[model samples]
Target: MKMKKKNKGGLLFLMSVVLGGFLGGFVGMFKAGAESNGIILDVKILIPWISAICLLIGFISILLTFNFLKKSRKFHSLYQEEMDDDLNEIYYVQMYRNLEFGTIAFNITTVAILLALFISVSEVVILNRSNLTLSLSFLGLVLIFNVQKYFYKTIAIVRQFDLAFFSTPKDVLEYINSYDEGERQANLEQSFRILFQLNQYVLPVLYIFLFIISFLTGEIQLLAFLLVGAIHIYINVMQLPMVKRYFK
Candidate 1:
């Protein structure tokens, strides 16, 4: 029995999960202590800093994802030449797809953060959980499990393809194209389109409404939500120009 080498993207995800879990746990402990002391968490005192941190993390992750996508695009462009040799196209393809999946997972995590911020600002406790840290830790664990499951499933599917049999560039191209075609392509396109539209239009309008309400009511908590929305809008705008290339 031999252990398989972990994919680099998978390793990065593992690191992120571990880091996120620890951070969440630490924050949870502080939150628990604050609650125990009968200290009401001041949104004005805390949310701005927390939101700033979240925005920084989100931006870094988005930048890394963008770089990975650019690299994958480059690889695809040169894949024909690379396939002419004995290079393992399967490995490259798996790596590319893994990065893509990682980006999607990160985006999902960012959205979750935004949702949490929204709920906190609006004082809507859907889960009746008073500890923000515990909630964050739970979210981290859930994301970790789901991301690992997806990566494993993707690897299994990639393993099913006999890349060694593809001796010609045409064969490699066909195989890659086939994988990107049909239902997968349609779903990917649809998802991207929806995301683009939501981020491009719906989110900005929603944020404007929230911002105006917050300003009128003098709610400091909404600052975090507004910041998160602004960062998300910037990210979406940056990625819009590349969407066609990404989905193509």
Candidate 2:
């Protein structure tokens, strides 16, 4: 089961990278073609498409949030039962380490893609007075915020589990007991829900704000932002099921 999960994660990572690359390349080609034809595209052309995609993302996030709530209830019940059973400390420690590694890998890939996009788009931005450069740069900053958040959270989890792994079994059990309490568990669930919920709302708002800036400034490189936004949404949404599975 663990191996299967690991393989599934690898596949997901591969698919995300491929999809991102394809979208980036497709936009680059379109821009090149447009320039060759002596026709400059307006950012306004992208507003409807971006808005539609954002709406779709918002709808999906709402559904996922509802599903997550149901899963959380099931998870809490399962967690309580597990706490009463003969728990495998080694299994949990390994799980945290795996999660940490996966997070690091994800962050690395995301940063790589962001850098590539910036490099590819910078030349076009510099040549044109459009706000595409500024919009993408701002989006990059938002992506950085998300990457840092995930990294910090995973690091904390890894550290906690690392300590648990080295401690005596009795100490590990004590720590688990403290962590698995009703209040602590509820807080954990709430925190997870809030983090995703914040991303769901905050990201669309930020993107819309950027869209306005791009539209007004006439520097609309909507394709890049759309691609990045899609990837971001995809990653976050994809994690919901994994989060549910983790608790299971």
Best by TM-score: 1
Candidate 1 local lDDT, 1-248, one digit each (tens): 12335576578679867975776576667667877888775444554456445544544554554455455545555554465554557546745674565557556555645644554443325434354543554454455445444443443343334433214776645445656456368667987887887776667656655654454334754666767677776766777667977888
Q: Over the full model, what C-alpha lDDT does candidate 2 score relative to the true structure? A: 0.53
- Give the per-residue lDDT digits (tens) of candidate 2, residues 47-104: 4344334333433433343333333334433444565443545445444445434444
Q: Kindly state the number of residue pairs that clash in model 2.
A: 3
Model 1: residue 116 alpha-carbon error in angstroms = 6.7
Please give the RMSD of candidate 1 to the true structure: 18.6
Residue 131, candidate 2: C-alpha displacement in angstroms:
22
